[model samples]
Target chain A: MTWDWAISVLGILAGLCTTGSFVPQVVKAWRDGETRAISTRMYVIISVAFVSWLGYGLVIRSWPIVIFNVLNLGLSGVILFLKLRSAPPRRKEA
Target chain B: MTWDWAISVLGILAGLCTTGSFVPQVVKAWRDGETRAISTRMYVIISVAFVSWLGYGLVIRSWPIVIFNVLNLGLSGVILFLKLRSAPPRRKEA
Candidate 1:
């Protein structure tokens, strides 16, 4: 196969697999209604990174990069939202 | 700023933030000495993705992409390693 074609195939396969890593976590969080294990800091940082990537993609006029990051950002945002929402209620004790 | 420069800036910023997402998880996994919260399947998938990204980067002759994904792949690999190592032992019950 041509180098470009080979790379494209590799890219598609790898992208799908790595991106899939987050799927189980999302499902678990959704199913059990608990996100205690999820880290808020992580989400915050990731959101920032994804936004940067989106900006980069836009600047370069690369639709694939932009679209992928946009979707990733959305997914990460959902996890962050759930994590924040599920924070344990603070208690006032005498 | 030129579009290329702008995109580069954005790429760096976003890359840092999104990549930061995995840090806490790694630290937590390390600290707790437990990877129960981590998903092996997720790691498997991400490793695949990172490889693809690397291939894409190489194909496109993008050094930044290639370097970044290589590092990301390594980081992801570490997590996958730990998760796999910490898998709970199966039990046979009467």
Candidate 2:
């Protein structure tokens, strides 16, 4: 019983750290209006991954996974949107 | 039994997507040597989170979590190192 509680606490803490970590990135991107150093591919892939994780969470009926992925999706989406928006338009080859 | 396989597949897929997503980011960061748009706070927090997750995985005896967190720690560390290295020297307050 006590071990279960400890495990649960650790899991929750880990989840919060991973999920909430994106908050600062989002804030920096939004505030600075800069994403030159940020990786578009990373966000793109992670966004898709979050969707998969969300599906997995739903199938497994794990609320923590579902919640974290939902939040992650939102955060990742914002960064991707900002990065894409700020990107320089590609020029056609002469 | 089949359902068990399906669940396992979904879990693996989700794990792969999240873990593999960082590859592009690392590649970009290495090639460009830029991290201005990235958030130091996010990486710092996520690095700590990865450690926590690693610990949790160990306690739970989950190989996937352990492996993923280890990979994440390495990836996140590189980005953090790049970001910090590229950071402009802080000016002392008057």
Candidate 3:
């Protein structure tokens, strides 16, 4: 196999591992209502970050980056929404 | 500007944004003792996820991927340790 092919395979494998990691968090949240454990700002910021990466990937047409970011974009967005929905709205303070 | 250069710039910007996103979580955890909210499994799993990406990036020799993963690896490690340190240990279930 060519070097580029090997690298692509590695990227895909890495992407799968990282992507899979979020599944447990999602599951934990669903099963235990663990969304409270996550910070709303974290999820929101991460969603934006992944969206930027998704845009970059689309522009460069790198499937590895594109695929992972696309998947995570949806996942992070849902997580963010869930966090916001479940958490008490921040109180307005002087 | 050349297409490749533009893509690289985009990738870097995306990387920075994604990398920056975690700062809030770390700060939140430190300031609010918010580690109670985070699932230990999430950080542990995500750390492994990024380590895999780091390996892939190193193999592929992609500087953008490598740089982001490296920065994130240290950050994630610190966060994971903090989560473990601050949170109460899981009980021995019958």
Better of 1 and 3 by lDDT: 3
Model 2, range B19-71, lDDT digits (tens) per residue?
Answer: 88888888888899888888999999999999999999899999998998899
Identify the leading candidate in terms of TM-score: 2
Report the lDDT tens digits of candidate 1 across residue range A1-94: 7776876667666655655667777776777777654567877887788788777778778886678777778877877877888898889897
- Residue B15's lDDT within candidate 3 is 78
Question: TM-score of the candidate numbered 3?
Answer: 0.86
By lDDT: ranked, best first: 2, 3, 1
Show pairs that collide, candidate 2.
Answer: none
- Docking model 2 quality class: high
Q: Candidate 1 regions off by >4 Å?
A: A90-94, B92-94
True lDDT of residue B10, candidate 2:
81
Clashes of 2: 0
Per-residue lDDT over B1-94 for candidate 1, one digit per residue giving the tens place of the 0 to 100 score: 6767765767776666656677887776677767665557777777778788787788788887788788778777877887878787778796
Alpha-carbon TM-score of each model against the true structure: 0.83, 0.95, 0.86
**Per-residue C-alpha lDDT of model 3 across residues A1-94, encoded as one tens digit per residue:** 8988887777777777767767766766766665654767777778877888888888877887898898988877767766776787789998
Off by over 4 Å in 2: none
Model with the higher TM-score, candidate 1 or 3: 3
